[model samples]
Target chain A: MTRILPALAVAVTLSSFGSFTASADPLPSWVSSGTKDQIVEFVTAVTTPDSTDYVTPADRIAVFDNDGTLWAEQPVYFQFIFAMDRLAELAKQDPSILTTPTLQAAAKGDLETVLQGGHNALIEVVNASHSGISVEAFQAAVADWLDTARHPETNLPYDQMTYQPMVELLRYLRDEGFQTYIVSGGGLHFMRVFAEEAYGIPPEQILGTYANTTYEQVDGVPTVIKAPGIAFIDDKGGKPINIERTIGKRPILAGGNSDGDFAMMEWTSAGEGPRLGVLIHHTDAAREWAYDRESPIGKLVDGLDKGPGMGWVIVDMAQDWSRIYTGAN
Target chain B: MTRILPALAVAVTLSSFGSFTASADPLPSWVSSGTKDQIVEFVTAVTTPDSTDYVTPADRIAVFDNDGTLWAEQPVYFQFIFAMDRLAELAKQDPSILTTPTLQAAAKGDLETVLQGGHNALIEVVNASHSGISVEAFQAAVADWLDTARHPETNLPYDQMTYQPMVELLRYLRDEGFQTYIVSGGGLHFMRVFAEEAYGIPPEQILGTYANTTYEQVDGVPTVIKAPGIAFIDDKGGKPINIERTIGKRPILAGGNSDGDFAMMEWTSAGEGPRLGVLIHHTDAAREWAYDRESPIGKLVDGLDKGPGMGWVIVDMAQDWSRIYTGAN
Candidate 1:
């Protein structure tokens, strides 16, 4: 996938503001200084007309970890919130969800209670909410809930609260001719719901963890059966593995914001030629929230320590980025 | 899935000096005055904006059977030929292949002898060539071989021998905003090699028959392991099942020219919108050889009758299409 333009430059413009510009002058104000400088330098090294790292637009592969890198992953994942809301909505009809461990813990609705149980609690909550339903029904349920759902804490629909800068980067890269994909631990189907509308990337382009689907004949026609199988887990160490296995290309640009994304960034940096590795350090508490090493969610200290001048850019979310989200109304 | 263009009328333009524009400004020469009228009426019904047969671009999903539909599938499947070459290439280095029934058959270039075993032959051939190779290595091998090898029958590289008229039709449909995908019985990995270059489709977009692959940690890097699992066949009735299982969307346009493709065309026509089923009947034996029910490849009987008045266009290859493969230099 050859990129027509530089991704970092385009991303800065997109992340900062939503001002459409003439194609000849696509660069924006945020294209220089701080975070943009690091991004541009990496791009230049890899894409310079005659640089050794110079790969044609056809090989300008870039993959991003969606959770913290592309959006907000805080006290609890947004999907978990969707599940809790679903549980409450379904509780009116099916009260046993109140007794299901994961649903019960979610119904309790205290962040501390969830952290007490750890990863087990998270997977349990997800399986309880997502399994059993047909893939269509699950997708419809997700789409319906996403249409009206808002994060209780942020007070904005989860789609809006997505990191504004990341969205710009994706479009900038795509406009430049780079193929941008979401490789995340999040349910691949869940991401497909708002991915295209919010990010403008199609469902086929987004690759993430997915439950297995079965095939069967229905009535006179063949219909697919959606079942819960651990078909894919596109997260943590799985990120790089999944990308290579599916896309069959090594990414030149990789951006992530947590320990979960550490391996993904490492994988990008290990690839040949001029490469870009970036970490979105959340240090803006007033505009956003700041916590890295000590935070339970999105810890990035290890990556930051490794960043410095190691060809990896550490973006100070508070200062480097100028806006939150485009949230197109 | 929203398209930017309005529905363009599908017309065949014919000229008085024995040339045709392949559009309907002046009907095709093959469609007699009566046949042309019938076709115009059918097209009118299908494309009428308010008719029960009107189909939106979103509903214009087109599924194409590869093999004989796109490129020549004569002298046996191109994949088998490649596998035979590969077996011979790698045979000296690995002697155990001689003991493997399928490997021996392929290595010896006695494919017909191998097929004497019937289903067992197909199983052995697929397992030997595909299984155990890393998906990446297999893709590389395919790309490498396709780049160098020429089809014995055509003397043109396999990719160069694709049907030109069909290629143009595919481009036309894509320009019209139809989502196109290859539904083939060929091994998924093998098709991924030239699919994008030949059909303008990405590998991830292809849904085909597959022998499963596993995951293994080679050295420190995790690599996908391709194994000879029970093959996932995407031929005949399996085509629709695989399509529904993978894409979960039904196609409105289906093009194929074999019994294996009949089930696919039937599946597409079953959709509730204005459907188009085109059968490429090889009526030309001069420019190209013709065969039907007795031929081992591309048998086109069922689709011819069952598909006629129901909006199916039976292409008289000799009369309807002017060019075969696009000029490959």
Candidate 2:
């Protein structure tokens, strides 16, 4: 706790430096061309007190999709990795899980078999790995997994796999008085574990897919037990619905990668104001994995085709981002 | 929006004056010698940088139950009034509603008949009045009702029925860098209509019971259609459950006034380190309605009995408050 002060002081100093140079380069990781200008122009217009597009600080909500938009989700969604890891650990504890067909398929990295189970199979995997445990216990498990988990391709800690340009954009938005939130398709509990540490966004500001939880007293201790059922799915149409129910306001700015975020972008752009819709087009095969319409996971075909018509900025990751991963170019 | 600047300046000036006189009176509406002291002490210890109980600004989450804790709930919860009002209005437009026995009873102010219909009946009424409408339409309806509706007993607007002391406490907490959230059993849309204007808390910070909603393109226009079903109930055990699901952290400070709040307080207090639980006991029959321990609505028996043992401050409304309603004694 004491060490946190010096780190905070350094962050404050860095932030002050960023603010001073905001007009010149708030998003240093972003190229000084293309969508960068649009982002800066939109942010400036909304933040200027006398500008017609100026929005109040309270209403300056900006939502970002976690997976491909903020971090690399190619190969597979990070939460799926977490789920698979949990299955392996469980198999070690109770060898019976290794024999279970679906669990066995998951353990062998046979994603095709797992997906064949369809939505129900996916829910089964999520429940088996994520639920029937106390929330505190789940959080601890996630924290421990995150501390050690690394991306198979990069061998970097999963948190370090976050996009540098998007990280800068989040910081710039916050500095410009916008409340940034992670409206993700990933599990809420999983996102909460590292949201603050990785993204500098608090857990409360992160809304994601969730499971039903029951409150019970266990030996005079109050505990929230995560149940084996989906409470909400924050994808496609569900994104906009969950945002409205949880945040109670439409975001002024929304960014996502896949077609799943199409409704969210539409809902945001439909608002009667100066709204910005950003779609991250993953086209950087050299720096990162490249997938679009043909990909099974995080398909971006619909959003890409609709981007121009909807006035959404399609960020060409290969062109717009000067840097990809946090510490890599 | 321009007018807000001067008003904010005035509030800043007033707050400075209050700070200088903080030792004498920080909460003028609250009695000088009561739970007020405990609240101030807890806030001071947590906000102080060097104190062992120090909490970062980001972690200073303070949850408040809306109905009985922050505002009056006697003569029935205010939302019930809104629901009944909506029923009457709908009955005027469509005479068919008159044939619905429960709605007819609600329109006639026959709460006995309405309650006899049980939880399912209550859900039906909520969906009838709140759902099957666009989110924007429902918000407008709530706004219109709040603009004209008055408490049957006090003859004051429902928003004005809020406790002056609690208002002060909210302001005080905000001044000390605590983010305040309204975790209520009332409808989320209903609460959002007036939460910002009445409490200075933004709609984004307000969480409440909500109905299922669907995102649809109504005539090619993106709209969220409120669905006919209870999505979440934010009361009793539900309070803690929603808090965890939404906020993803245990509140350090929690205030409520019913048996429904018992689990919320327990969950909040169960967290490690400095915590404060406050139960607003309705004991002021003269200044405000007084019915606890056996009241049908906002029952306080379990909470009141266990408050002292849990180190929760049970606020006796008669003795603890110098003023009850905002701008009234």
Estimated TM-score per prediction? 0.76, 0.93
Best by TM-score: 2
Cα distance off (Å), candidate 2, residue B105: 0.9
* Candidate 2 runs further than 4 Å off: A1-24, A98-100, B1-24, B118-120
- Give DockQ for candidates 1 onward, in order: 0.15, 0.81
TM-score of chain A of each: 0.86, 0.91
Model 1, range B92-154, lDDT digits (tens) per residue? 788677666666877888878776676566667666766787788888988999989987766
In candidate 2, what are the lDDT values of residues B120-170, reduced to their tens digit? 666667777787899999989888888888887888989999899999899
Against the true structure, candidate 2 reaches a TM-score of 0.93
Poorest 10 consecutive residues by lDDT, candidate 1 chain B: B5-14
DockQ, prediction 2:
0.81
Assess each prediction's global lDDT (C-alpha) against the native. Answer: 0.72, 0.88
